[model samples]
Target: MGEEAAHRVHSRLDVLLAERGMTLVELSEKVGLSVVNLSVLKNDRAKAIRFSTLTAICDALGCAVGELLEVQGEP
Candidate 1:
């Protein structure tokens, strides 16, 4: 088999929120989640997210999943 490639992905919430002139508290309220939960997501510490939650975040932020998360090739 060919060598497997490894990649890492990071969150763009901080940047996107800044661009939109929003704060984590606002996002949390809009997304119907707690600040702590949103912080986890914003800091890339979340392991899983519900589809409904994802949809809510997308709706609130006016962004798609692709715009929020990006892939980084192995260093």
Candidate 2:
């Protein structure tokens, strides 16, 4: 029950973008984030995300933080 029990964050950006018919490039331009950064988030490789960045993405995608991120347990 140490850091091992810490929740892992999972990103659902791909599904969300698909639902909105948006591409990563489009999202990047709209949210002012680089495609590489967005790709990291999309592929679940991002170690962390800034609150402002998350807010911007949410605003541009018309989604909530919960919709883009979810907590999961390590297997």
Candidate 3:
């Protein structure tokens, strides 16, 4: 499953939230996003994320874009 797995982008949202002692509910509220949207991202099912949303999330999490999103595969 090397190639298949490589194409998958895993979300570290859960880890970040836990590390910061924050919950998805809290993040969603702070970022002005719905829990469903955040949950999809957290579950690694989001097909795409807007730049604004990413910025807001990063800001709310006090993390950089690199810390939030990562390329899983070697290109």
Most accurate candidate by lDDT: 2
Error of 1 at 30 (Å): 0.9
Full candidate order by TM-score, most accurate first: 2, 3, 1
Task: State the lDDT of candidate 1 residue by residue for 25-69, as single tens digits.
Answer: 999988889999988888877767888988898899999998888
**Model 2 deviation from native, Cα RMSD in Å:** 2.6
Query: What's the lDDT of the predicted structure labeled candidate 1?
Result: 0.83
- Which model is ahead, 1 or 2, in terms of lDDT? 2
**Per-residue lDDT over 1-75 for candidate 3, one digit per residue giving the tens place of the 0 to 100 score:** 575565567778988999999999999999999999999998888888999999999999999988877777556
Off by over 4 Å in 3: 1-7
Worst 10 residues of 3 by lDDT: 1-10
lDDT of 2 by residue, 2-72 (tens): 64356388899999999999999999999888999999999888878999999999999999999999988
Error of model 2, residue 41, in angstroms: 0.5
TM-scores for all candidates?
Answer: 0.83, 0.87, 0.84
Name the top TM-score candidate: 2
Runs with alpha carbons beyond 4 Å of true place in candidate 2: 1-7
